[model samples]
Target: MLSTVRRLGVRGPAVVAIFLIGLFAIGCSGAALQGVGAPGATAAPGVATGDAARGPVEGDQNGSGNQPPAAPADPLIIKTGALSLQVTGLDAAVTAATQKVDGLGGYVSGSDRSGDGENASASITFRIPAARWDEALAALRGLADKVLTERSSTEDVTGQVVDLGARIKNLEATERALQAIMDRATEIKDVLSVQAELTKVRGQIEEMTAEKGHLVEQAAMSTLTVTFSLKPNPVRTEQQGFDPAAEAEQASASLVSVLQGVATAGIWFGIVWLPILLFFGIVAGVVLVVSRRFRRAGPGDDTPPVAPEAGSAA
Candidate 1:
C-alpha cells in the first residue's frame, strides 16, 4: 500500500504532462498527415487498400472525389489609424463623427472633451468594422476644416491566430483526455491529483480561448483615433509665397531689438562703472586746481610782471 501511494504521487504529474504532450503532437500530426496522404489518396498502390480500409469514401456532393470548397480566408490584419483634424466647431464635429460611426455599424470606444467654445477640443477613439474603415475615414475627413495629421498602420497576425487556434484545440483535447482519466481513476488520491490537473488545464484553455477571441475581434475591427478642435489651423505660407511687407516688418523688428540691446547695455554700464568714473574725475580736477595755485604762490613772490625795453631806463 505504501509503495503504491508513493508511486502515484511521483507519477501523477508525469502522466498528465505526457498525456498533454501527446495530445498536442496528435493535433499537429493530423494536419501534416492530411497533406502527405492527399497525393497518395488516389495513387494506384494505396488506392485499393485505402478505400477498402476507409470503406465508402466520402466524396463531394456530385460524387466527384474533389475536395469541398475551402473556408473563407481570414484577413488576420489588425488595422489602426490616427487623425488630427481642425474643425470649425468641436461639438459639431464630434456629433457628425458619432453619426458616421453609428451609420457604419461601428461604435465609439472612448472619448474625451476639453476646453470650451473656440478653445474646445475633443479626442475620440473608434472601433470601426474592417469593411467600412475606408468609408469612415473619408466621412471623418469631411467633418474637418483641415486635416492636421493622418497616419495608419496594419499588423499581420495570421501566424499568431493560427498558432493560438492550434494551441486551444490541443488544450481542449488534453482536457477531454484528462476528464476520461479522472472518470477511470478509482483511488481517492489519484482522483484528487487528476482533478487538480484538470482544473489547471481548464484554466489554460480558458485563457487561450480568450486570447483567440481578442485576436479575432481585432482582426475584424479596425481602430481609429481622432482629435477634433475648434481652433483653425494656421495657413501655410510657403517661402515661395513670400510677402515684401512681412519681410519689412521682420527687418523692423530686428532693428528695434538691436537698439533695445544697446540701450540695455548702456544702462548696465552706468550701473556698474559710473561711481568709479565720478571718483576719477573729481581727483583729476582737484590736482589741476592745486597745481595752478602752487605756480602762482611760489613763482610770483609778490612781484609783478617783468618788463622788457629797448634800452635801460635811468
Candidate 2:
C-alpha cells in the first residue's frame, strides 16, 4: 500500500497519513461497540478520504520560481548628416567617408540624388562601426564646407531592448508552463486550451525575437545621412564648355533679328514717305524749268505764257 501510495505522485504521502487516521478511528469505534455490546453500530464502512486527499501539490508556488529572466539590451539610436554636393563628386567623398567607415568596419546603406537644376542634392545613408562613430563623423565633417550644418541624435533603446527581451522570455516561460499543463492534461478541452496558448506564446516569442533582432541591427550599425555639395572651390573647379545648343539657339535668334531688321527697313522705305518724295521732286523739277526759261528770257517777267510757239496757232 505504501509503495502504491508512493507511485500515486506528490499527494501520496499526505493521503497515506489520512488513511491511517481513518483506520485508527475505525478500530477504536469497533472495540467500543464490542465493549458496550452494541451490534451493527461499529462504524459505517465508507470510501477512504485518502482518495479525495490525493491531488496536485502547490507546484507553481515555490518549485519553479526563480529570479526573473532579464531582457536583452537594445542598441542605441544614432544619426548624422552633412552638406549638399554634386552627385559625381559624392562618390569620391562618400568613398572617402565610407573608407573611414570600413577602417572602422562600417558600411553604406542608401545613396541617391534628388530633384533637378540647382535644387539638386545628394543624400547618402552610411553605417559606421559603433565604436568609431565619432571618428567617422569627424571624417565626414572634413569632406564638407564649414560643416554648414551638423546634427547627431540618440534614442535610449535600453528600455525597449530590455522590454523585448523580457517579453520573449515571458513567452518562453509561458510555453514551458503550457507544456507542463499539457503533460498532465487529460480533458480534451484542457489539452486544446494548452495547445492554443502554447501556439500563441510561440508566436509571441518569434515576434519579439524579430523585433529584438531589428533593434540590435540598428544599434550595431550607426546611421549617417551624409549630404555634400560640390564645394565651389577654384582649385577643384572644372572648366565647363559653353552649351552648344544654347549657342546654336543664340545664333538662330541673331539671324532672326537680322532678318527682322531687313524686313523693318524694307517696310519703312516703302511706307514712310515715298509719295511725299515724288511730289517734292515734281515741284522742284517744274521750278527749275521755269527758272531756266525766265533766265533765258532775260528781263521778261511773263515767261510762263510762252507755250503757244509753233503750229497750235490755228
Best by lDDT: 1
RMSD (Cα, Å) of model 1: 12.1
Candidate 1 least-lDDT 10 residues:
63-72
TM-scores of the models, in the order given:
0.58, 0.49
Tens digits of per-residue lDDT for model 1, 228-269: 987655787877877999999999999999999999999988
Q: Model 1 segments beyond 4 Å from truth? A: 1-72, 231-314
Candidate 2 per-residue C-alpha lDDT over 131-243 given as tens digits, one digit per residue, 9 for 90 to 100 = 77888777777765556666677776755665565445334544554465466666666667657756766776787789878877777777877775554434656788889
The candidate that achieves the highest TM-score relative to the unseen native structure? 1
